[model samples]
Target: MSAPVRADALATLTAWRPADPGQRALREAFLGFLAARPDSCARSCEPGHLTASALVLDATGDQVLLTLHPRVGAWLQLGGHCESTDATLAGAALREATEESGIEGLTIDPVPLHVDVHPITCSLGVPTRHFDVRFLVRAPAGARETRSEESLDLRWWPLDAPPDHELDDLLAAAQIAR
Candidate 1:
């Protein structure tokens, strides 16, 4: 297994702000879900574990930054597993955004926008349930693009008419939610 990422480093990502009502409600619901089934991680959601991620919206609020996922061949948000280094789930999401998107100076909300529990296929072929904590992020105004090896491609698309053809069901759901 790879070395776990650090939480304190993740915490240094960005500042936080009060979450909106909708976001707070979502967070509460997610927490409740976790509380109800304490062993969901090791049992129901085995193989995969809890994760955090960020969906970066561009300046105009009409487009989002997406990565062309290599394995699934879909355009998706930036995120990864919540490693030991993550200060909090939100911090992990921000760290993922900065590392994967290569976009600097992203402003992130401290609270998650939504928490989704879903199964995803990894390279190993076993279906793993990812307890995904998602946050909304915004890049600096007029920020330029940057690329990383993890992505096949990175681009901004109009939210109104996203490139759905290049996305999978989960990513498509995220697009529609935005």
Candidate 2:
């Protein structure tokens, strides 16, 4: 990623103060990650890397778009690892949302909606942690979604009552976004 993109991510994280103890710990950890590696956001970063993701809401904000991730086999919001072309974490989230959702003109809330650190076994058999910075993205009215190759299926789900076990963080992020 470019210097400006790195700077943007740093700036955003620096300004964020999480409301809860768990989130506060995540913020500190993310800051540490940024300090430890300038290319922390890059997918190639060994051991762990940063990722950008979104809780994508429909135009009315009553529904959310989710993808059944092929690898994880779970319904998740659109997102992925940062790309060299991304100029900001928000940009990365937006790009991932647009690409995965196959929808254009999606508007993203600049402030981060959530932060999480999770372990994953990559395709190459390497274990890594994804320090995910999450944002809230709003889709345009009458938007139609197409499934990307990364997903087994893509669908819109009611925001008021999401699947309890699978989307606890997403539901919490929705509350934070609102």
Candidate 3:
């Protein structure tokens, strides 16, 4: 419900095109939360806790590697929390991709592609918020991958026909902008 989060959620929801009933509901709920809680802050079940994540593009710049998130069952970029050990947000993103995708020789652009703020409804029905700072990264030339346990599946996807998911539009936009 912070101003930044509210703005991000608003933009995301407006640009979103949900492909399934469940995703539509989820998207609506997220949009509604932002509309209702313009100033709710982190404590109000609003998106908070900044996390650094990445959309890893391959060396040729035609494909992006994505992971199938365990909980969400959706294809997404590799990223995680910026723990105390991380020197900067970009470092956190690098560590996460290295750990999650097992792809070596990567370089991340310091600038974030987008700031995604979303509320993750946990199994216990407790919602955790994430203000995800998403960066654009590139794998070394001809670098191969070994998907880690963190992802159900990891593979390179074309920028135009990324695997079906709710964030497809956002991902496409990010790729084009990059």
* Residue-wise C-alpha lDDT for candidate 1, range 1-178, written one tens digit per residue: 1123223212322222224454445445455545554443232345555677787888766678888889768787788766555556667788889999888899886655555666787543678777676777888889876878989999997765667754343344345545
Which candidate, 1 or 2, has the higher TM-score?
A: 2
Candidate 2 residue 91 C-alpha distance from true site, Å: 0.2
Q: What are the lDDT scores of the predictions, listed in order?
A: 0.64, 0.86, 0.70
Between 1 and 3, whose lDDT is larger? 3
Residues 1-178, candidate 3, lDDT per residue (tens digit)?
2355445435645665645455466556656655776543244443445566888888888888889999888888888765555656667788998888787789997655665667786333577876566778889988888988788999999877888866675586565666
Give the clashing pairs for model 3. none
- Top candidate on TM-score is 2
Model 1 clashes, total count: 6
Q: Which has the better lDDT: candidate 1, or candidate 2?
A: 2
Candidate 3 residue-wise lDDT at 97: 86
Clashing pairs in 2: none
Candidate 3 has its poorest 10 consecutive residues by lDDT at 39-48
Candidate 1 collision pairs: 5-85, 6-85, 6-86, 7-85, 7-86, 7-87
lDDT of 2 at 48: 84
lDDT of 2 by residue, 1-178 (tens): 6666678888998998767788888899899889899878777777788889988999988898999988888888899988888889999999999999999899998888889888987553688889889999999999999999989999998887765467786577686666
